[model samples]
Target chain A: MKPAIDVVRLARHPKRPTSRDFIEYLVRDFVELHGDRRFADDPAIIGGIGFFDSIPVTILGHQKGRNVKENIRRHFGMAHPEGYRKALRLMKQAERFGRPVITLIDTPGAYPGIGAEERGQAEAIATNLYEMSGLRVPIVALVTGEGGSGGALGIGVADRVYMLANAIYSVISPEGCASILWKDAGKAPAAAEALRLRAVDLKELGVIDGIVAEPGEGAHEHPGETMSHVRKAIAAALQELLVLDAETLVQRRYDKFRRLGAFTLDDGFSELI
Target chain B: MLTRLFVQCPQCQTTHFISFFKSADYVCSRCGHHSRLDPPRWIKQLCNRGTFRSLFANLKSLDPLGFPQYREKLDVAERTASGWEAVVTGTAEIGDMPVALAVMDPGFIMASMGSVVGEKIARLLEYAADRGLPVVMVICSGGARMQEGILSLMQMAKTAAAVRRLHGKRQPLITVLTDPTTGGVTASFAMLGDVSIAETGALIGFAGPRVIQQTIGQKLPPGFQTAEFLLEKGMLDIVVPRKNLRATLVTILKIHRTRPYPVRRRGDE
Candidate 1:
């Protein structure tokens, strides 16, 4: 297995294939949708209706710019309240049309800013989690890059969740965790290891269904090969999920998430009760 | 001993006798700053006398990832908070209206949600849904516990999904947003309440103020992320004073007790 810090570096590689690149590669005639309807459209998240091979799908992801100017435009892939709301809007539409919904996760978490909070960031993300639970459509999600805390989970909560081989999914960024734990952000490498955020680790922990293998070096080194793996993984997941009825799909999705977490019951507590 | 006798209000810097503050239900007598309360005090404030029966009190957090110092922190939290986890969940009676209640104690590592907290809360909701009881949650957290890592993040979805399930049963979830609700807690079940009420002067938002300041590199406007600000922004349904919270909740519970009017579906009409 790769060291956690190296995986983090590869995940944040500037040349890595972003959500837009994956969409372009996997989706044909992708009609990009815009705006949350309740607020201004956030550039950080991009979504649309498109065809994944022969099947029509609703696809969305956190978009990081390939360059500095683009990064500024995309807010470094950090979504605001409107971005989540827009994703939710498209998802509800997908459910109504009986289309499978796909989300690519890549964010350093939600934007922490005055406008974002004032516009109800928490409510926006919360609404997505609630609505997605009963979306009544096959849904698959891939963490192609940084799955940072709730921002990533905002669009995540799928029947099947996958992660790129080199991707990192964590409750908090290593730097943030380090600063809080040790009061020094320089301990991020150690924090990264401790977080067990590597794709393989997450898969073992049952946070993700599987890992989409990356190409030699990383996704940036071979985008075509990486996208192929992602496409295959998503296809398999959708195939499995599509067979279930809406009620079963939703219930199974609920059960899947319900099984996550680690705890122990005190000896005094009776489980049979 | 001196510190025990005289307590300073974090918001107003008003120093007063501990007994005096306790008598006021931890609200500052002069400036009206509501001090954080543990589960026991919160239960006393909200539930009828001798009516709160604690449930899921035996779930304990394990060091799932074996992260450094996590066990030590949990040990300290158990000792300091006098509870197994950050939240104390149970069935309680408010205004003689039986309801399921979950009170998050900020004293327990800032009420961070980890495996145990998530499990307790999800189980509480499931219990309430099974019995068709309303849920009243007192939410006060700094967000997902970092030590548990990705599993902590997963709790956000787990709890939110549980809330969705409860709503599916037509059971109401009334959340009381207390001081310092932020992060995953804000972005999950806390904000999913059918009626979201905040305590006056509570600090409520998705991101912490310090984080916003660090990101924007400027001083935040006064009263940013406060209950009043959320109310102005239309994110919250109401903001009630700390003393009046129980009465307001009782009223809301009573109103919810009425059977909801049947609505026509798209094809039914």
Candidate 2:
């Protein structure tokens, strides 16, 4: 039997999955896709088709390495413009095949290096936003861990969005936020609370559709249980979306975002009432 | 209580002495200018008469994040300052040519790019693209709104993408970076203009010089990331003063007028 799991330990000590572990555990019968066609394939974003309980789906995710060498190999999940282009390519393929796209969002955001900008990182992300809004297939994105800036949102637009309990989805990191707001990095926790970045807060704000239940307090406690819950949630979401036709799905997707912040004006004459 | 009458240029920070009650109109002595101009006033200065029509005038912000004391703070700021958000964007005519004008309201939250600001800018770009109008954005900001958090930062991408769509269509996007533009907003469309322009003495940079210096453990050079420095370094095409902004924009728009609207060949369109 596996060692007795400590919930606190699992929550407190979170680590990223390795390439092999991610491939073997999360993906079954996976077929790796390659290239942006215009440039060489970026190792930052790994995407293709796979099966979850015999249901075919497209899996797109940001990969992080276990060690220094592997981290360098994956550019520490920092993607070039081609990385976004590759994901774009796979998304188009998924649409063509009428498959639901399940994206695992885990990145510090797109690479902001000089090279990425020269190759039009901004342009690539813009293209994705324009193209994804019109995609025919259902998309369901999950924030398994960190969802950083445009890098995460580049592939994160979906009919239903889910986040793991302890995961964070933010435009910028807490440290970055603290630095910007307070001019001090030590105030990160203050920034974190101010950012309202946790899954719970996002769920409250309608930013996230749901929170995928993790095992024994967190995903790290049992990877198997976490993956199972994620698969089930995504499958259910996809099933619900698939019932609608393409036009309805598109309209629903548009309406979903449109209705996110529905509010009515409160006139200054409230005291008269 | 008598408020001090001072006319400090947003660009140069040059204080022009003026008597508090001399001009109720608040004109600067040295520069012969007003310290803060309303959006309509700026539009009138840049565009032909009666050409400007505001877009998304009905869109107001919602405190979705439930920011601590956000409503109270907003109310206080509203009471003390001009009744508007960060930016006002819409279609207008500069001389004979139809153009889109986006002017930042620095009086409001330091002209931070919150959701409404982002949405307005995006809609302006989309409208320009649809109608084949040239876009001119007068950027002045201390960057994203901390109260809005991630949503505010998303505006960086949102605005950049909106501008990119226009650019892809071969539409001209003229960014006139004004004083104190910094952070994520500057990192995006503010720097991605087809023909980038700046007001003389505007502070334009990804991060503030002080912040960058403290982070990098090095002293910044004199006039680092200023409009004059950026022009010398090729990040900006030209640096026009507040007095010349309207005329310079007209000439730039006129020069690019010869190019025909790009054919829509991209599949997404």
Candidate 3:
């Protein structure tokens, strides 16, 4: 029988692609960039220019450690404020170099430790948010695993956003939602359903652009299939987005984001936010 | 007998009937889960009668990304959740003081701050500051809008800059934290309010608790980042229940209504 497949296990324990794993899977030659320019380099978030399928693309993503010691070193894929700043730096670099930006979002979110905030965590994330919207590059973001929150959103803004079939994206986790709503986290399944967090659900809800097909069951089942699907989707999306001239691409990107989750009331009944 | 609104119990799968109006009066009975209420109902509950003028009332959403059938999906969500975008900005009178109010429309995408919502808020904050009005923002967000891409994150700086402007104008900016305030919105202006207040039992944090625990590979303490935790950590000044929010705002506003109003002069001057 196939191994017992828990989504969380797939998230935490799959013999999966590390951030560098994409270098081989997607990029041909990666020129690594380091540091926030204001401070020391953060190993947690690896970013730079790379050739994805020979298409010069800015490859940026979060790197988590495989073992306990590395996970600690990487902050368990939770980026510090500088990590985000580094991403912002690389994105701007891509803009300067006139390269299409492809960001792989794998972090749970930005680091929330006291040190991160003390060093302007909020400011870093805020600045990225500000600069990225106006950057002149075709951005295609993929949530390969856990797109937890702003940490994911840090590198997550793109002309086209895709999520792996088993990947989940939500403002918060279902367990957190359950604790908040039901006061009992055991009802996480209910919270998960209520959150509409699966790639399919998010795509259906118009929250995500598309869901890259995974291997049978989930991404963990067929790693090669998942990687191939991601590759194809990225190729197609980049081709589509790169067709537009810089101004049109940027404007379209801006407008595309300006409109999301809009609805009108039919009667006096309740509505979605 | 008042027909109870069919509230999906947060506990059991069964839907419990509660008086729509009265249950709207508070949280759910069976699970104590906060029932979703519209911005209008919320404003009515918190503001003086006939006192609100909504800003950006005509700011319709436009699809910039052209996600296929996005409009239809929006239609379904709007019908189901009953609000536009995820935030409603306006000027409202509370306890005879005109305050700029921005309430998260939780029914809409967990009150995610998309571009329109962020723009509306920034504009409202600017308007309030220009008018020298005190601002009261009730934040109940899941966070920045995923669909809006980088535009949603921009709201963080825009709103934060507006808040800083309000501070420069010497106007009070009160942020009321509500359930599920996480992600970009909380990491930005939501956490930057001058006098932060939270609803009882509200979840207030930058990232979700589960993500943190997962990242750290540890079990989180009970009530790790709730309103109580925030208050204890000095992130919040007060924690008020929904039932008491209006009176609390009135009391706080009355006590701090000096800067916005023209100073009274003595005859000696």
The model with the greatest TM-score is: 1
Question: Which structure among the candidates has the greatest DockQ?
Answer: 1
Ranking by lDDT: 1, 3, 2
Candidates 1 onward: DockQ, in order: 0.74, 0.20, 0.09
Q: For candidate 2, write residues A43-125 as lDDT tens digits.
A: 98888888866768888888776677877898878778899899999999988888878888878667755445446565566
Off by over 4 Å in 1: A268-273, B1-5, B263-269
For model 2, what is the error of residue A180's alpha carbon versus the real structure, in angstroms, after optimal superposition? 4.1
lDDT of 1 by residue, B111-188 (tens): 999988888999999999999899999999999999999999989988999997787677899999999999999999
lDDT for position A232 in model 2? 82
TM-score of each: 0.97, 0.73, 0.61
Better by TM-score, candidate 2 or 1: 1
By lDDT, the better pick of 1 and 2 is: 1
Model 3 residue-pair collision total: 14
**What stretches of model 3 exceed 4 Å from their correct place?**
A1-8, A262-273, B1-52, B56-88, B91-183, B188-269
Model 2: residues >4 Å from true position, as ranges?
A: A1-14, A18-23, A34-41, A50-57, A72-75, A93-99, A112-121, A180-184, A243-246, A261-273, B1-41, B69-81, B98-100, B122-136, B140-143, B153-269
- lDDT for each candidate structure: 0.92, 0.71, 0.72
